[model samples]
Target: MAVFSLMLVVFSLTTGEFVVSGILPDLAAGLGVPLSAAGLLTTAYAAGMIVGGPVVTLLTARVSRKPLIIGLVATSVLANAASAIAPGYAVLLVSRMLAGLVVATFFAVAIATAASTARPGKQASTVGKVVLGLNLGIVLGAPLGTFVGQHLGWRATFWSVAAAAALALLTVLRFVPDRPSATTGPVAGELRVFADRRVQLAIALTAVGNTGVLTVFTYLAPLLTEVGGFPPGAVPVLLLGYGAGAVLGNAVGGRLADRALLPSLAGLLATLVVVLGLAWLGGGHPVATVVSTVLLGALAFAIVPGMQTRVITAAGAAPTLAVAVNASGYQLAAAFAGWLGGQVVDSGAGLRAIYPVAAALTVAGLGIALYSLRRDRRESSAQGSLPGGRSRTS
Candidate 1:
């Protein structure tokens, strides 16, 4: 039941964060804004996630984790309902931004909640279950929104999201136990964990890697409809294929990370460069575009679990705060990518241009990962040469 609660939170957050892609056109039509302007909705929402994560974490420092999570999930329901009934685009955008705030809090608390409840030695798997919800959201939620919007109008998609959030709220309330109060130290002390060099590197990689993914995804609709010449109705199918690949990549990445940490991280980033480059090159060919989309999803998301574990390991003392910051890093990357993608599109480079730009970012991230890997090896070699040659005697 506790795991189920975590999954529900994951599903709600995933759907709320991503449903925008499927309904972007409808939103533009209803809001009287150009698609480029309407893309601000995603950017605004991600910005909210970036700001809200730390604020919520700090404010709730003395609160029990379970009740706080339930409240956050309930807020998701209300925001979605507000979005569904919004009379104009401004209201809908604000509502979605609030929904983003709710998502940040829910995810941060869910990870904390999962860690608190996990059996010994199963922490990684517990974290994975929560993440599976996020991946499932990417895999399943957008398609659901697109289908509902196509048939019943865009408002119906929000209505369904509201309903799902309500269900998640109930599951969390019924199953997850009340958490103990968090550490009572000043929040600055909590934040000091991020000062570690390796922690900084891990967050940098997470930020850049996610930027690489969203730079392409933020423009996926335009590429499919305008560049690839796909019918509008086929959008969901392509996204679904991408989602399927994401799930596969996530599962495989998790296992690989468990077995070999830094190697897996470097390998995933290298794969992203190849996959993103292929997708960029294939943008003009329809069959090749579809193939690229699936590969794009796989290569991009494959880093999530591994990158997350890397941060937690590096920030050993304050894993909860570290994980929350990582979520913020992901949102920051998405917001930047969306803004950058929009600039490229509005500048006459066209939507396909975003892919090459994204590919370049992936390559840059791989370079950072390589530097961090070398640093790790050098430190290990230095440690091996320490006095007494690994003897325990003082």
Candidate 2:
């Protein structure tokens, strides 16, 4: 029940993050902005996450988990409400950013809480379930919010998100146990974990590795309807398929990461590159495009649990702050993706161009993962060696 409530909290908070994707056209029109310009709303929210995660986590390092989470969700409710009532684009943009500010702290706490409850050796699976809330927000909340936006208005979507967040807040208060952090200490102490080359690599790997997926996903609506020739009404249904794929991917990825973390990421990233290319090639065909959509969600999200585990392990004693910083890095990359994708759309390369470029970014991420794996092996080899150049415990 605690984990489930935490998932519900994630659902409400994250719905605000991607709801703009589903209702981009409507929102752009409603706010009297260019479609391209409206894409920045996504960027704005991401930018907030980019700034909020590390900064807020550092500040609240000593706060109890349950209260911190409740406060964060309450902030989300207010931010979404502010978005719903914004008088114009600037106001709405600020509101979105504000809503984003609470995400990383909330997520870090939720993840720690969920992990604390996990049975030994099931960390990845349990983390996957926590991440499932994020998947649910992406797959279910965004589409339903979009459906609501289509029927009522874009503002109505924000209003509805606010209500959902409020309800989740109650569940969080009821169910999320106050699992105190063990490493709660001075900020200066926690900062040293970033000095580890592997830790730095893990954080960069997340930002660089995930950029491609975010790029394609940020522009999915236009790619589906404008390029693939699907009607606007078909989007919500297609998103459901994408959502289904995401859920499956999360489950499978968790199990794989539990068995072998780096190897699993390598496979998933390679598959992601191919799937992204397929999305590009299949852009013009409705059937193929739909297939790519589901595969995209699956491949894109399949890597998350492993990535999270990688950084947390790397950060060691400062896992909470590491998770927050990692999430911020992810949003920083996402903000770049939204900008780069928009540039692709405007550069005469068209929306299809975004996919190929996205594939390239994923390739870079794969390279990073390989390097990190190689380094891990080298360090393990060194540590296992004795002063006399012989094996230790074997």
Candidate 3:
């Protein structure tokens, strides 16, 4: 129940973030702003999440979890409401950023809260369920918001998300329980984990591992229309398939992570490289493109839970700050993906070139994962040589 409530928060948050693209034309006309200016709303939200989540999380680390999430989600609800009623582009843009500010912090706390309730080894499975909300937002919430915007108005879409956020806040207040801090030392101490070589590597792995797949996804529409020979109309449907695969991958990935974190990540990254290559090679074939698209989504998301688990494991008792930073790293990688994809396209490489290029990047991530695993083994073997086989964190 608690985990589901958290999922609702993510669903609402992400819905608000993604629906901007759907309502871009309406929003531009409504606010008398250019469409390009309206598109900045998405960048604003990403900026808020990337910059605000970690700083806010660090500042509020001593607070109890339940009220903290409630506060953040409630703030998001109000921000969305503000967006719904905003009279100008500046107001709308700031409101979107406000709504985005809570995303990373909320996710970090929420994942930890959910994992705390999991039975022993099932932590990753629980985290996976929480992550399912994100994929669902891409699958259901964005489309629904877009429809509402088209039929009603762009402002109506914001209202819809505000309502969803309010509902999430209420349920979370009811279902989510307060958790005592796992480590009660000075909150600033958590910041030191960032300096640890293992922690840094884990965060880097997450950023690198996600970049390739996301770059492919960023250009998916063009890839489908130009390369796969699918009509523009089919793009949304294929995205739905991709989103569905993400949901399934989350389920399977979490279970695999719980069983073996590093090995599973290594295997998943290797597979993702292969799938991206397949996507590149078979993109012109309709059936092959469809199959490869779904597989890409699955393989890509299957790596997430394990990467997150790796961060938490490496952080030891200071996972919250580490997790927040890790999420920021992911957002940064996403920002980079768009730029990288744009660069590839502008270089006169055909749109089909995205897959192999992305695949090569995933290969780098795979190398990092294996290297991390090797270091883990070395540390474990060294621990076994000690008097009581004590584990090492740094």
Give the candidate number with the greatest TM-score. 3
Choose the strongest candidate by lDDT: 3
* Tens digits of per-residue lDDT for model 3, 137-217: 888999999999999999899999999999998899789999875457787787888888899999999999899999998
Per-candidate count of clashing residue pairs (backbone under 3 Å) = 0, 0, 0
| Candidate 1 per-residue lDDT over residues 145-217, each given as its tens digit | 7789988998999999899888878887788888775657776687788779999998898888678788888
The candidate, 1 or 2, that scores higher on lDDT is: 2
C-alpha positional error of residue 182 in candidate 3 after TM-score superposition, expressed in Å: 6.4
Q: What lDDT, from 0 to 1, does candidate 3 have?
A: 0.89
The residue ranges of model 1 lying beyond 4 angstroms of the native Cα positions read 24-41, 85-93, 115-125, 149-155, 225-231, 345-352, 387-394
In TM-score terms, candidate 1 sits at 0.86
Tens-digit lDDT track of model 2 for 127-171: 889899899898779878989999999999999999999998888
- Model 2 clash pairs? none
In angstroms, give how far residue 251 of model 2 lies from its true place.
1.1
What shift in Å separates residue 117 of candidate 3 from its native position after superposition? 0.9
Minimal lDDT window, size 10, model 2: 385-394
Which parts of model 3 have CA positions greater than 4 angstroms off? 181-183, 391-394
Model 2 Cα RMSD, Å?
3.1
